[model samples]
Target: MASCTNWAAHKLVHAWLLAALLVTLLTLSPSLSAPACGVLATVEHPVEAGRPLRLLVVGDWGRKGRYNQSRVAQQMGKVAEAMNNIDFVVSTGDNFLDDGLASVDDRAFHESFVDVYTAESLRKQWYLVLGNHDYRGDVLAQIDPALRSIDSRFFCMRSFVVKAGTVDFFFVDTTPFQLKYWTDPGEDHYDWREVAPREAYIEHLLETRRYNYLDTLGIRLNSGSATELTWKVAVGHHTMRSVSAHGDTQELLQLLLPVLKDNGVDLYINGHDHCLEHISSRDSPIQYLTSGAGSKAWRGIFQPNEDKLEFFYDGQGFMSLEVDAGLAHAVFYDIDGQALHNRSLSKSNRQHVDQAPSLVSQE
Candidate 1:
């Protein structure tokens, strides 16, 4: 009877110890207990005072060089070579295809990403977000810091900010905002480990507190008396306004668009429809750009929305942006290394002056 009593006491002690350990972990890492959207990691990419910040944006790409992904990459390399000093590349999302990485050791990472974008100019840092397809596989594997060991250029997170000179790029995680992913995800299984109770997660991510840092940065810039023009660009995997097959993501239009408009976001860039597009907002000055044609493209999928469609190309292509203190210019390039359309916006004293987009002749 004494031995039994001692064993019971020992088991109870172990239980208490385990509970304490869990509490300690939660205390040490608040992220384990709850998502803290305000604490997103910021990556700084400095630019020279007089030079304009240049970058190439691609999405819906990773397919092991298949589906004309390699061809598009070749054109991207050519464009980067012409620019000569491309800063970095922004991958809107869907880094992997139908599903995401099965594991950190998945060969698709090398076959699709490493072996594919093989250009001297394409060796710069890559900032990426997670698409809905990414959630279908090991979501943790893609964002795992360990993957950096394989390629230092790989920098991805749930949602983060990249501050480059006058532009502050806000990369948002938009997959969780969709209701169908949780309620009607037909045979597909999404790895929503850290993002359960979607409402709280979305609320925290879109909270104004998360954007206070940008406001502070703006104040600092304005303190110099030289009327510095600050630009805010938001990137995500889902589209707010599009004329392609996927059209508009209603979830983002309702929940995320208002916050972006309120925060003075100048451009919302996304990739999901596997086509290149540009749409102008009627209510706000915000411009919507899509560069999802990194791989396969829809040939004849067109669905008009309420907004003004500036440009639309139902073929494989990518987009490039060059931003300075006053002017921001964007160009869309097709798989044949031809410029299809171009647009420019000039700002003075913090007011945007929109320029009409012109079609580039294929000659």
Candidate 2:
């Protein structure tokens, strides 16, 4: 019986090794520079004394080929191995490059996502949102609903409120305002309506308003008693304020920042511009973090008036946050989890602040 068990273990090892080799081969291929891997990160940290909820947050990922997207996946695997409590992943949009999810079961999403975050825990749940790219690609609803059917944990267009000790999480989708194909209107070949609903420039501005900032905060505050543990976090993909090519998410910020200040949401996490940044908004004391360096890194634009900007780097890497009562911490690293930069948020500071995270190229 022992020998039979040993044989099974050996087969499993061989299968994993084969998978690794396949990934490496894809990475080495010149044509498939990006190949296929999960651009979303996988991490584990016990936020409280209860169930550990490790979250993988990313944006502007899914380039299938081109850049170091595969390296990001390899590094995230290391993070998964280090923690036992991680159960799910979340993203801010731009799930695929250019735009759209392939057909519902198209192997691309899984190949790029599922296989990349191949960790047992990461496969558990994946909550997604729209990015301008998704709108350009096609109706993401088709794939989103199907993924949920396969696993109820894919909380697309849904809210996730889970507690890990003292911390409360508000996982949100921030893809509505992402302008589809605006990055390059010339390359678009399909009807604009195919992806996101067609909205005139002005109407789009009003319709694609950022999430009602105060409303979400109010929901959170109301969801949990004022006496509930203090660490409250809000996350999405677009930047509330930044100097990157994406510019500042002004409208969204106007609605959200004031509320974040009023409610004291601990941290603002996003990944629209692909870089590593921990910016403190002069507008408020909130800490804004950008960890979208999964597949590629974008060059950052530093501004002189950017008050309270703590740290910013256009490097290739990922981030892991360790929160357990009392303190909430963040560590940014290369694909391997090596410490690049670090910071912690006071219980009061984390509740709310205005300011944010990303740049697209590392050049």
Which candidate number maximizes TM-score? 1
Q: On residues 52-83, what C-alpha lDDT tens digit does candidate 2 reach at each position?
A: 34555656667773467777766665665565
Ten consecutive residues with minimal summed lDDT in candidate 2?
35-44
- lDDT score, candidate 1, position 340: 86
> Clashes in model 1: which pairs?
none
> How far does residue 36 in candidate 1 sit from its true spot (Å)?
8.7
RMSD of each: 9.3, 15.1
lDDT of 2 at 57: 60
The TM-score of predicted model 2 comes to 0.69
Candidate 2: C-alpha RMSD to true structure equals: 15.1
Write candidate 1's Cα lDDT for 98-212 as tens digits: 8999999999999889999999999988999999999999987888766778887787777666778888787877887788998999999998865675554444334733323
Q: Cα lDDT for residue 69, model 1?
A: 98
